[model samples]
Target: MSHWKHVYEKWRSFEQLDPALKQELDKMADNEKELEDAFYTDLSFGTGGMRGELGPGTNRMNIYTVRKAVNGLADYLVAHVGDARDRGVAVAYDSRFKSQEFAIETAKVLGAYGIKAYVFDTLHPTPLLSFAVRYLKTAAGIMITASHNPPEYNGFKVYNDDGGQIVPDEAHQIIGCIQEVEDELTIPHLQKDELEAQDILNWIGKEIDRAYLDKLAEISKLATGEQQQDKDLQIVFTPLHGTAHDLVLRGLSQLNFHHVDVVEEQAAADPEFSTVKSPNPEEHQAFTMAIELGSQTNADVLIGTDPDADRLGVAAKDSSGHYTVLTGNQLGALMLDYILTHSVSNLPTKARMIKTIVTSELGRKIAADYGVETIDTLTGFKYIGEKIREFESTGETFMFGYEESYGYLIGDFTRDKDAVQAAVLACEMAYYWKRQGKTLFDALHSLYETYGYYLEDMSSLTLKGKEGAEKIAAIMETIRKEPLTEVGGLDVEYVEDYLAGERTVIGTKLKESIELPKENVVKYILGNDSWICLRPSGTEPKIKYYFGVCGSSAQEGQQRLADLKRDMEDVISRVHNV
Candidate 1:
């Protein structure tokens, strides 16, 4: 018998299995392929915590699998964190299927281990969960969300004491702890009644919400009285049926932005994301309804947040009288400029903004213009959050942190990418320029005119199941063994192998250790801020090819991007064919 079949049989035979899950198991009893896919491996943590399609299998996300992960977390905290039981953990969830149930299970699992849990009573955004870990001073936090993944998926994100996603080092330790839980069926968890009786499963809200809102207020700059009178500059907002449905609007309202209109079709907490194919804010299709609303209202700007509200996307009226979506890098650069301009008095000497390595250089250049240094982490926002904790002790103030995936963090109140806080700041920034008789599009164009027109694009290839994983690994190995020396008639200046933590200068054997943590990433640098980076998606089953270039004008930038993309696609075909 196959190992996966054995695991499936064992789960099926368990008497205490969830009835719904048992039904699913029974339905797949004769479907060997489905059973194997479902049970081939246990759900594991990626850059985010355990995330997978919801199903009744060891590899899928279900009650048993979720319980196993939470049990491991509880055990890890107990053994490594002093007084962890008393400090406890905070739990929050999004509007995904089974998110609330998973949150409850997380609390019960902690309760079984005598660890207190402060579980939110209603669905909330991911950043709020990060903030709860700090505001509550919990040992750690658990957020039940798959972020911007499709409706069929769900995830478990764990945050350390600093309210940041656990870094690679911490994730490694937690993985080991999870491995120690040999049998998912044997994991123990307290019932809700039992948990309540022991005072281990406390419900929390209201106060944390108030505190987070208050913190947002401190960071949100009020529009000048003249800016306030620019009431004709309408704004369209949409949460895309996610957790920020009310708070983001309330946030804008608190700042006295009363002319805001909402995309009513997507204002509710909908798990299916019925209106959009995917709930991701980064994609243009996600803004279809918002764009319609914006056009109808003649709104000056449009904003959208991902399902968990950790990422925010923006679109504004361009000089062409059409709504153009701003890429994550463009928005980050604009916001950085606004923040610096407004914060000249309060700017620290060593203030800095952080971005992922794959993010465009425009923000870095903008930061430099303001005498602010920009630091690059690997791909994950966890690294940004980790740096925030480090900077706290180093006396370097963290001005902002953003990635090219539309995730932005302005205030340090939340360790993760915070769309709500970003929404507040972005609205203020848009309004500030509105008072100057300009739109965000105009402000963006001014930046490009000052700085060279920088452009970035990425392509992702989806691979599924165990075989797909093998191919992804092979693609990385092939690329690493034979690094590119030139791309699109441009010479590769350096090849940085992040997995080896080494950067090798082209034509020279000279090597320098990379200052960041080692990860399986390969990047090729070209002259003039043109480069290529290939990395596996941390949350999804995909490999990504990122290309960026800059030119004196938009047409030049567009041509360069097309040429680079064409070259990279050829490289991908060669690697995949092998």
Candidate 2:
């Protein structure tokens, strides 16, 4: 009599179910727990779209689920855009399992709804998908990728016409449309031949790629006249078996950087990402192959991009000849410093930079030093993209935007964080430092000395499945009920509860409204420029704790950051017990 059981029965009785899916259902007939887990509820689609393990159930990602999602998007488009077919939707997929299939399925669904679909001929990076939305002037866009998740996981991301992820309001509307569908198994989709004959599906490739790379080339600082001096700077680059291998190589080569070496083992388009435990560039283990290549080539710097090539990670050889992975915050600071310092003449008079609430304060300081204003948005690169759009309307220039999770954007040509541009900028930074007889590590030290020592660290705890989801909600509720007054032995100056849309001053308890859109996040400001933020991951089932502190010396900053992390962990443990 359970809802999931009833849904499972309906699916089992469906005559048109795919044979493979039917086989899976038969295999799970005797397994009650497995059935419950797979059919408990539909995979929740929000601003980030749906992500889950590949399987044959409502909670898993399959052809049925993909069709249902696209059906909802198609309906939403028809409702919003007057001529949906004319506006169309652009589609791109990465090198993930079933990515191409999902992309095609999405196109078929849209075509059945009389909406045109512009799809890439092959796998492309997420940023390029964003660019294609603007280039082709589509009503929306969809990207099929899990974006650095493990091989077992895949996802879909939806974007608005502005080339950014759908904002909260639009996401709610699309969710309503998705809920209206009574059965995922019965969602309509046109045959490929039918769509092609009707001209409802268009294939896009070389022209868009050329336009995007040309725009990226314009953002390069080293492409001007200093390429000759930087041509000898050794650089090791790896795409982590994603979509950046060819484009990044082509971009770097066009910039006249001849000493770049690619990690051959990881150059191929690999969905399994067999070389790394996880395709995430944020993890140190993901750089193993690139580090090995860096050592062999005596490269000055190493750069790696995630599976979708939107997030970038960098490692620089330190003084001791050991490769050290730079944190996302560190890399952002370095890129901001290099870009702002070198491009001062060309920067707009009212230029500004943006960072996420969970990102480090060091970027704000770096922006301040360069006389640029810094704005903070909720976590997620989409919010950054939204800010870029806002700036465009206001005639304000967007200098740079980044988050602590290795996502960076230099030019607004693409709304999302672009690893292609980041990789090239990082290489150029390394070469510039080389001309000064220094490594990026040395440059970072100099930055710390100039801007005071700032340290940041993030910790995430993954809680999976339905029970884990309930536990996560309970944890957030508990924290909201009993807000921390102080952390790490520092007095809490103020508390910003984004979910409640209020900032409460600790001593006076005077609350003010927060201007940003509502999200389930809480941040506690402490004395001595230390702070902590707690928020659930948007794309993953994990609660992340971001800790930051500023100190007069590197040793002091490291110790303070350690203390903050310990305190934050204790707080999480206490809340978990509740």
Candidate 3:
């Protein structure tokens, strides 16, 4: 039998299921393609957690999968900790498809295991879940969200007691427990009201929100009277129909900014995200409404958060007075310079900035000028969160951290990337720049001057279906077997094979050791200050190639990047035959 057939039969054998889930699965049975896509493989519970389409299949995200993941977590908790039932877990969900239902399912699974569970009463952002984990002092946390993925997708992210995602060692333990649960149908759960009667389930709301906001308020430092006097700078914000609408606005309003406007049409909690093709704010098209409103109101800046409020995107009026969207790298560099210049003067000399290896290096230059250190982690923001935990354990201050995918975190209040905090900081920086009779564009130009111009771009090649997955694997295997010595008219100066934990320089006999966790990623550094990185998507059938180039001027940077991109594309196409 085919894999889909086996998976479908397993689910069909369940003696009882909620009527709604039964109906949904029955509806999918009529479409062979949909059934196959839904059941081709079980939704993976990997290093981060489980993510998949929300529907009725072994592979889809539903109550059953949620229960499975949570049950595994409960088992892990029982084995690793003493008095696990008293320690409890924190649960929060965003405004995505069936997010609330999944969160409830997770709670019931925990409750059935005689474990305590504290869940948010309503939809909350991902960062808040991270905050609640540390604030409530829970043993673990679960966030039911897909972050910035499309409306058709949903997910669950697991965090440890430190409010960061599970690292490789912990993830392996959880996966082992998940594998031990052979019968999903036999998994236990509790009724919502019954769990409430037991007093093991608690619903948390406003108090936590207030605490989170108060911490966000202290992210930027101002003089005694700055908040009251700097109130006229205009800005527009949109949540992209996610969970951060009110929270972000409240945070900004608390800063005493009077000229802020919310994109009312995009403020509603719509799981379908009808206002945009994709809720991801990283793309300029996601800000169409915000830009229109900004142009009309002459708003100094525009900000947006994706569905889960973990990622942020910004648009600023450039030298031409036209709205230009800032890439995640650009925003991180700007925010780093702004926060360090404003906040670090009062702090100790050992302050540090954290960024992913894939992030642009401009922030590093700025931090160096300020006499601060920058640390590079792997691709995921979870590693940055882990670093924050390390800092807390060792009494080192974590000033700021960001990734190149529109994710930023400040003040360590949240273990994940926080669009809510970034929105506040963006507005504050815009106000400061406005007071200087300059725009963020001007600020960026000054940054380019202080640090040389840096240009970076990434391209994703998405493959779907089982065949596509096989092809992607083949490509990676080929790259590992016959490494390229050159790309885009430049000699490969160094090749970093993360899979092997080795960095080798061409024509050199020495190989340096890397301390980071092993991942299947490869980086090729070229001689012209240009580099290309290749990695397979952890959750999807796709491979992403990132290219970076730096030059003496912005025009020179653009030209070099264009030429490099064209050459790389040619090389990749000829090699892959796609």
Candidate 4:
């Protein structure tokens, strides 16, 4: 009779459903709250594809939902491509629960449609999946991972032939195709053996790995002699029990980085991520193991990668002899300076850098000093990939791309953020500074001195479930309807409403259209060279606030950021009450 009840009834009527799934459904039969939460709506496939907790329901990540998503992709490839079977699709997974199973199931679904599926034989990082798409010349790609999410979560990320996540238009078409599939339970999948026998299924391994590693090696800016000399720099790395263990170690080894040590406890492929509360490298707690190892080895730098190994985090010893974690903005700025300064001779005539709008402006300033152009995209790395595609057409070379969330790309070989590449470059940067008797912290200080003190902070308020969804919508609507003219005693000189696709100058009341795609985000520019932006995270049930400020000194910058954060929270509290 109701939405949940209808879904429950439909799933109950499926005769061939897996017994485990049926058991899960039975457990929810009497729990109305849980049932509604699990079936009230389909798990959305956004621009990055569907991600949710693993369970049995339309609103969860399960075999049925995976089949449905893959079926939709299969149909789209068949309809849109000239030779879908020949182009095929590349599939990879990480070390999460059932990730390998999900990858196999996806291959099976595509195989049933007479579409070839190139799947990795073992758990691989997300960037390799992106590289596989281009190396194999696949029509599309799928990565079964949730990036840095907890062990309870898993997801499917779909990429186009260009190796970037599907943009809005293609995502819409795929969603349309998914909706057309009336019964997810009945989606056809061929047997793995049969698919292999018919040449519709293939397992990719060493060859792809070798090619990817070769391309990654090219990302190193240090000369062979320089890398050999820098090999004395002590380094510690941890994969956070995810997928980067092998490739990162091997990449560093290939570059002659001999004094590297891995946090042995966190080096294994652990689905539960037993070593940390969360697998996200962006969080300080995730670096606990690596930091300890760094101290023992007297390492110059420490690095950690999340579960899917697409994002990287770094910790370096300050002048006080204590390790301090660098925020994503800080790390991005350091990496940009390192790359541009070391590779000036090898850079193209028109080199460019790309960053998400939420990223700090300090990177732009550094790029300007190097005479390289900087471009801003929306929040997702997919948009950055799109810009790379545009650069290819215009004969502009992409030097680097990164997001505030710790994702980064150094070279064009991979269409996703690559911690492996970042780790290598980060090690080199640390070594370069260490050789000069300066720490990475010193490099950051020098940047501050040259570019003025820039401080940035981010906070997310997560609201879950149906009621929470409504509250999030209301918060965004209220902010859009009544914009803030001032925050923390700073005058708002301009307001950029991304949803409305316009930027308005408060003083002159002049408005200009924003050139980027429309998204539900609002940014306010302060007269003091500070800014604030509010946007709902596309992949999560949370509203994120980003604050940035520039001051005369580090202390001034930190204080201003604190004031802005407090004032912003007060503003949000009032808006929520309304």
Clashes of each: 0, 0, 0, 0
Q: What is the overall TM-score of model 2 with all chains considered together?
A: 0.98
lDDT of 2: 0.91
Quote the RMSD, in angstroms, for model 4. Answer: 1.1
Question: Can you tell me which runs of candidate 4 are displaced by over 4 Å?
Answer: 228-230
User: What lDDT does each candidate get?
Assistant: 0.90, 0.91, 0.87, 0.91
Better of 1 and 4 by lDDT: 4
TM-score for each candidate, following the candidate numbering:
0.98, 0.98, 0.97, 0.98
Clashing pairs in 4: none
lDDT of 4 by residue, 526-572 (tens): 96789999998877789999999998899999888998999999988
Per-residue alpha-carbon lDDT of candidate 2 for residues 394-474, written as tens digits (9 for 90 to 100): 988999999999999998999999999999999888888988999999999899999889999999889998988888889
Runs of candidate 3 exceeding 4 Å displacement:
none
lDDT of 3 by residue, 122-215 (tens): 9998989999989998999999998777888899999998888999899999999998888776799999998999998999979999999889
In model 2, which residue pairs have backbone atoms overlapping below 3 Å?
Answer: none
List model 1 lDDT by residue over 1-578, tens digit each.
98988998899889988999999888988888888999998876765588999999989998888999988888889989999999999999999999999999988888889999999999999999999999999999999999999999999999999999999888888888888999988789889999999999999968888898888878865545643343455889999999997789777776777889888899999999999988988889999999998888898889999989999999988988999999998999899989988888777999999999999999988889889999999999999999999997899999999999999998898999999998888888887898898989999989999999999999988889998889999999999988887788788999999999999999988999999998899999998679999998888899999989998999988888888899999999888888
